[model samples]
Target: MSVVIPVSADWLTLREPADAAARSHSLARRAARLVHPPAVVHDLGSGTGSMMRWLAPQLPAPQTWVLHDWNADLLAHAAAEPPASVSDVDSRVGHLEHLGADDLSGASLVVTSALLDVLSADEVEAIVAACVRAGAPALFALTVAGRVDIDPVDPGDRLFEAAFNDHQRRVAHGRRLLGPDAVAVAAELFRAAGWSVRTDASPWRLGGDPALVGEWLEGWLAAAVEERPALTEWADEYARTRAAQLAAGRLRVAVHHHDLLAWPA
Candidate 1:
């Protein structure tokens, strides 16, 4: 019998090995060119502060991190360790929608990790606008609107990805909006909001790795595929095949294309 995992705030915020610390360092290094030194940074939807743990070292000295999230449990976890290495740190327990220029008045750079695709275009636009208004150079990495085909060997690969990616673009703010090209939509929004944008792709290869991340990807993608009845038949097929492969110790990788940074214009 499969394990019946309980859903809760802290459990939901945990990261797998696929969420490599080094990947965030790469993002931070790329962002260094665009952001100024001695900056106050904000990580929107910052659950557990992993991005801060990853990116803070690469940035110049006297770095201040403002981690924003709606869950107090998550915020508490994030605040548990304000880096002895970092110059200063603050944690705000609140929703991202309430975040605006007033919240970011002193912030120079803003960042988000694995958070954008979960929201709609309008919400994302508003967040970008707030950052722009604050004159903060922003870096948003690990958003998953596009599914790059990393494991071509999976038989039901395209069938599952097609459905899930479709689900991503369907709704933004309780209403439907274009989300299939979520990263692209975000880049355009940033540009429209007077942000100079730079984008890139970071694919999470599941091969030659451990099993924890593989399980996470399987459930995550399967949930996305199951959301639409139009995809039910294909999703069932994909799930069975994928689960068997996973049980047999086969490969399952996920490609999460990341958009690097969109700076103030």
Candidate 2:
């Protein structure tokens, strides 16, 4: 069975601003130029419709959105909270791997956020192939590159980072996740299939949000300890120091990510 993590709407809402700022403006414009006057966008693994909320104003008006997610509640929330520029909203409840040309049939563009790293190589290939078959431009943003930086650096930072990445690469349900290696593989796969791909740095430079920092830090250390159980001995103290720094406004976080736009050559 897959070890899928359930994300609450509150968490999605909390991260929306950071996501909005980290997305590549140039790439979004390039995608917007693909279709004139109006566009039909299919967002894969859309969480609380943050992708739609971010991209709608950047593109032209009269847009239609089809949001896909495994959570029925998220789908309902997305459909109910259509952006002002959106002409209509449709929700599809399913896994990203099940996405196909048929699902993207009327879409002018495809988009997803913070999703690629958790997917297996085969799943990414399938999604790319489906996009190719559908003749749509795909913009995938905020894919983790397995790099993390925290202010007042601890000597154990690298250890935790490596452990976390190892955890990400773990196989579940017989599929090996690409983890931090996702960006390189995705770019190569798209290119080999005759798609022109452009990429931009979209790192999250986080500070001054203790709540977000605490939550993110908790998840980060949890995964690290899961991969390297030995880290558990040091985890509590490390997290305590980090949390104190964050509370005192002395913490800074830099999480490296990349945004890619793939289209027919």
Candidate 3:
């Protein structure tokens, strides 16, 4: 008998939350170079201010943080109790589509985590333009076009991922598509306009994790592969294999990808 497992709203929003927690910490440090001390940081789509939690302390004192998200609950979670030594906390509650002309007047760093993959191409360019106009460097992480896996020995993993990616691109309103591939494309988008760009690996791995994330991953891949008529046979096989893997607790997930450290040139 199969049982339904309740998942957290935050976890539901992400296929790999643990990866953000584990991998993004180190990625924050390297991204700090583009953004110096005494900075006013805008963690756009700052769900629970995770990036602020990762990037703030490593920089100078009196660091003001602005956490922005459409979800008021998420903004409150990030705003109500800020990290120690934070100068002040401001929360922006609105859709990311409207972020371009909003009042990010004095930002020193424009940071985002795992948020860019959900945007359209026009939105990305708009965001890049906004950050450029804001005159602050951006330490963006985990744009889906740049998924990176470290030492992934599983051959079937990439096959499954490729299928899943195809599914994401076909999503309606052009949602959840990889805006670009390879880290260089993102870098060049900024670099072409003369912004300095740097990149590093912030890929996430389970490393023998025994958690329900596997169940979520199974559902995600299953839905993606199952979407295609041509891949229907493979989808059945993949779903069966992944389901069995989940039931027996032998499943783990890996997120390999590039992190962009960008600012206006």
Candidate 4:
């Protein structure tokens, strides 16, 4: 059995702004400099094509993007809202884990955002191997770094954080998700494969937006409770208190993440 985590278009839509803001522009510029014109960029786990919209302008013109995702609905949404700068867009519906060098061949760059952490170690290795074989540089962005800080701290914050991190690393359908360790693992793999890797902090400094923060808090607490059921009672209270703080404009959160760029050494 394969692990399947369903993602909604609403959730993707809600987070797109924050995702765009949190991405490392410096790293994106570096990636842009490395690629030649007429780029064929493959964005794995394309997720409504947010990565493409965010990155296409940074690259050269006459660009072609192959958006890869398993969800056809998301692909449809992506295809409908193609980036204006790109010359053409192609959608491939399938498991990105099954992708090989041949699939990525003729790619100038490979990219993904908020995707590495959800993948198992072996799956990540496969993607890295494919990138190497295709001789393509890669920019993997916004992978969670397993550290989150909420302002006006609560004692239960650490409790929920630990559990949530554990949940992120949980095994589903025989695959252990890499979670917070994803950036380090991927950097090591790229380096071992003779690729020069650079990583930058891309944490979301979330505040002033009640909807995004509240929704993120809800999901974060839910995952924590799911991982450690004993925290259910505590989570309820925590959620309520956080909601109150958010309403009062007192809640702030820094959800840490990393952006990694790798290229031939």
Candidate 5:
């Protein structure tokens, strides 16, 4: 039994602007240099094809994309809305564990966004092995670093943050999730495998969007309470206060994430 987190297409749409802002431009440029015209790219965990929409324009045109995800709905949404620059759009439905050199063969670049933290150490290792076997450069972006700062701080903020980070690291179905530790571990593994790796900070600085903030806060607090049952009472009060502040446009949030670029050394 694997840990499954259901993501709504609507939520992915809501975060597109911020995701575009948070991705590293330098890494995208570096990845562009390694490929020739008509690049063949594979986006792992390609939720709603956000990675393709955000990245296709930065590189040269006549690009081909293979979107990989286990969810049929997400794949459908992605296939329905491909970027204009993409010459071809294809979908593969399966887990990352099923990915192999054969799947990535003839690919110039492999990419994923906001996906690393959900994986266990073993899963990430397998991904690295597959990328290495395929001799493909990879750009993994927006993996959570487990740090968030909310302005107009309340007493319950740290409590919830700590609990939420703990929740991220929880084991489900006998596999321990990497959570905030994902970036460092992945960098190390890629380096050990003789790939040149670079990292950059891509934190989301959110303000002026009360609806998005409220939705994000709800999920953040819910996970905290689920991790520690004792946090339920405090989390309820905290959620109410946060909601009120956000509704009044008195809230700002900073969510820290890291992006990595790896190429064969």
Candidate 6:
């Protein structure tokens, strides 16, 4: 059995701005062009509805959105803060792997942000199949692309990055996650299913924002250390040095991600 990891509202709130900044606007515009009026959008792993808030305006008005997630609390938060541009919002609290064509029966567009990397290949296939069955275009955004560049580069950057990527791909609760390879796998599946696919880079360039940078640094290093326990001693020193650089406003990081948009050919 695969377990869903609980994501906190605070973390979502913290990353929302960066996510908004990093998403591909041209893809959003293209998605808008693909959908007809009075659109019904389904957002898988919607979280606190940040994706809805960010994307609603780009879509046609009088829109209805079904926000799907495993966390009921987050669903409530999403429902409470509906986007002004949407006509109605519905919340579905369930695992996305169980989603089927019927669940997205009337969808005009299917969307998700920062979600694909955490899903297994089976889960990704299920989503693609659901979209194909429903005849809806799909836009998967902000998937990690296995690249992280930090300015004033340290010798350990590649080491930690590799370990962190390994941790991301680690099997958990009997499921093997796709991690950074999510975009490639999803693109291949979509293309195999005869969909027209387009992908664009959506890297989060972090430098001036101390809060986001600091938090991201901590999480990145933590994951790296978790995967390679032998690096604990060196990671501690590295973390400290990074913290000082962050405080001095000298650290810059480009955490690479990719956005994929697929539509029936």
Candidate 4 lDDT over 82-120, as tens digits, reads 677798889998897789999999999999999999999
Order of models, best TM-score first: 6, 4, 5, 2, 1, 3
Worst 10 residues of 3 by lDDT: 1-10
Candidate 1 residue runs with Cα over 4 Å from true position: 1-16, 21-27, 34-37, 148-152, 177-180, 208-210, 230-237
Q: For candidate 2, what is the TM-score?
A: 0.96
Candidate 3 wrongly placed segments (more than 4 Å): 1-8, 12-17, 20-27, 34-37, 145-158, 174-176, 179-185, 229-237, 243-252
Listed in order, each prediction's TM-score against the native is 0.83, 0.96, 0.80, 0.98, 0.97, 0.98
Higher-ranked by TM-score: 5 or 6: 6
lDDT of 6 by residue, 1-265 (tens): 5438678999999999999999999999999999998999999999999999999999988899999999999989988867788989999989887889999998999999999999999999999999998999999999999999999899999999999999999997888999999999999999999999999999999887899999999999999999999999999999999999998989999999999999999
TM-score for candidate 5, residues paired by index: 0.97
RMSD in order of candidates: 4.9, 1.3, 5.7, 0.9, 1.1, 0.8
lDDT (CA) per prediction: 0.68, 0.87, 0.65, 0.93, 0.90, 0.93
Candidate 3, 53-94: lDDT as tens digits: 666777776789988777777778777767786879988776
Worst 10 residues of 6 by lDDT: 1-10
Tens-digit lDDT track for model 2 on 1-265? 3325478999998888888988999999998888666789999888799999999998888999988898989888878878899999988888877777998997799998988898999888888888989998899999998999888889989999999999889987898999888878888988998999999989887896777778788999999998889889799989888878887899999888999999988
Model 2: which ten-residue window has the lowest total lDDT?
1-10
Backbone N/Cα/C clashes per model: 2, 0, 4, 0, 0, 0
Q: Tell me the TM-score of model 6.
A: 0.98
Residue lDDT tens for model 5, 1-265:
5435579999999988889998999989999898777889999999899899989988788999999998989999998977888999989988887778899999999999999899899988888888999999999999998999999888888888899999999997888999999999999999999889999999998886777788889899999999999989888888888878887889999999999999998
Question: Per-residue alpha-carbon lDDT of model 1 for 117-227, expressed as tens digits?
Answer: 766666677787888788888888777746645443766666666766776666443555444455677788778876777776666666655455455566656666666
Q: After superposition, how far is residue 235 of candidate 3 from its true place, in Å?
A: 3.8
Ranking by lDDT: 6, 4, 5, 2, 1, 3
Instruction: Give the lDDT of residue 73 in candidate 2.
Output: 91
lDDT of candidate model 4 versus the reference? 0.93
